[model samples]
Target: MPHFVLPVSEVLVVADGWQAEPDAEAVIHRAIATAAEIVEADLGEAELAIMLTDDAGMRTLNSNWRGIDKPTNVLSFPALPPTGPRGGDNAPRMLGDIAISYETTRNEADDEQKPFDHHLSHLAVHGFLHLIGYDHEKDDDAEAMEALEQEILAQLGIPDPYAERMD
Candidate 1:
């Protein structure tokens, strides 16, 4: 069988709080790999970045980029498509960037009664989907996106994150 190549991800821990989760980077890498495989993204040479930050950093990003003054669990900034010709044959495609807030994610996991890693995986998958143009702007879009997320998470042995909401 042919080997499938997933995108190369660079994880940056920007906040000291993220140190509490030692396996955070590994969880993100696994989540992104699984998500890329499920989506069948042609990202063999593509690269993306994940930023693990705290609520304050996230608040600044949210406010500056989205004009929202609150901190969110995760945010994705999709890279704009390249307009000009390729610079080189080996130039890796720039996928985009994902930012996750440690405090927000932890709080959400505690409130939802889910494992920290499981919730982190969900957020990572969610952020990866956004990087690939999967959005939840509309009702149908949200349903589709959520279904995909559930599928990806299931493959990772995680329960349906939306199970509670559907009830």
Candidate 2:
């Protein structure tokens, strides 16, 4: 059996100016699970944090870190080292962190007419993939990554998010 070792940091769910839904915690857990499967990594020892924030906080972060000055649905900072094999934490492999904008997620879900859980799940999985060094900057990369995400999400009983886009 697989094992997951996600120790969530408190800042991940600070929830300032955001009223978390009843199943928000479950959504985070499911995201962690989906990420573990997608990356083919043993999650039992994964140590990471997820931050859920409103648009203001996310916008500030985006501007400071990425210089985008906009609230993105999700922003990921991977902890893996560059120019070397993955795994070099020396201190439990922190796996960096993922910051998700609650405002963006909620608005996107409302616009898409999908469940909040579904949209949140997609972002969580998307962020997790980034932590493990997955990027969708190119067509080939996007297809491969989306396929992996679909497989992982399906394993978690989620519909294929890319199906409609492909059609």
Candidate 3:
């Protein structure tokens, strides 16, 4: 019941880069489905956006929003407030947005020797988890979140993303 809205932003794609690796719509849709199943998100009353961009755009967003000067692999901007009621039928919840750095993801996948699709799926899952209020700010939090991620990825035929380094 997951609904995905992948709006093409003013994002550039490097030739043969991560942006060119996977079919954009298919990748986003798969990620959305996985996330919705994991969180039991009310797809009828929920909306999420995913933006695929390059490192430069992501750096600007990260610096402006997070005060970080460098571009990271993925950034999640959850729309949920810190304190709010769980759910209601009155409105569709804005699950916020996810921006992924196509450049960084490609480079990381090359460096780590992981399939580009696998990496993309991992990041999408990571970003979607954030929308559902999952975080890795501490040991316990990281453990819980990572476990869920692993579970979801496994269900999708993706290998353990943290199996090698346990990070």
Candidate 4:
């Protein structure tokens, strides 16, 4: 198991613009660390940034970066390229930033009838995978990514996020 410790300082919970559960930070760190373990990523001295915002902020970001003026649950901005070879064992990789919208996430959890922490963990895993060069742009890719997510989440004691929708 990789070092899953996410120092409280490494995460920035910006909930002034939105309301997030008190346990959001813990769930975020656990999700990301689980992902690092799944990918065998060496997280030596590496740092990650998480900004907890709401629908307005997410909509702005989605429009600015993805050209879709809508609020999504999470967005990942990877600091490294997906195609190149990774660094050595001693090297630390800046995983990049993950912005999560409280409103969207809460709504999604309610709609899916999933626990908030579980859904948040799933999104964090999903976003971390994107940072590490995972994509769901095609059917095969989606399957592979989702499988990885399910495995990773299971390690975190979380149920399959897609189980309800797989039917």
Better of 2 and 4 by lDDT: 4
Model 1, 83-161: lDDT tens per residue? 9887777778899999999999999999999999999999999999999999999999999999999999999999999
Candidate 2 TM-score, true structure as reference: 0.84
lDDT of 1: 0.94
lDDT (tens digit, per residue) of candidate 3 on 1-167: 32443322122343344536657547766866775676665445566777788888899999999999999999999885526666555655567888888889889989999988888889988988887788999999999999998988997899999999955
What is the lDDT ranking, best to worst? 1, 4, 3, 2
Model 3: lowest-lDDT 10 consecutive positions: 5-14
Ranking by TM-score: 1, 4, 2, 3
Best by lDDT: 1
How many steric overlaps are in each model, in order?
0, 7, 0, 0
For residues 35-151, could you state the per-residue lDDT of candidate 4 as single tens digits?
A: 777777544556667888889889999999999989999999988643576646645456788899998999999998989999999988898888777999999999999999999
TM-score of each: 0.97, 0.84, 0.81, 0.84
Residue 135, model 1: lDDT of 97
Q: Candidate 2 at residue 25, lDDT?
A: 62
lDDT of each: 0.94, 0.76, 0.76, 0.81
Q: Model 1: runs farther than 4 Å from truth?
A: none
Q: In angstroms, give how far residue 152 of model 1 lies from its true place.
A: 0.3
Residue-level lDDT tens digits of model 2 in 1-167? 44445544334566554476767767878777656855667544546788888888889889999899888888998775535666565455577788888889899989878888888888888888888778999999988889888887887788887776676
Off by over 4 Å in 2: 3-11, 42-44, 80-90
Worst 10-residue lDDT window for candidate 4 reads: 1-10
The alpha-carbon root-mean-square deviation between model 4 and the true structure, to one decimal in Å, is: 3.8
- State the weakest 10-residue window (summed lDDT) of model 2: 2-11
RMSD to native, candidate 1: 1.2
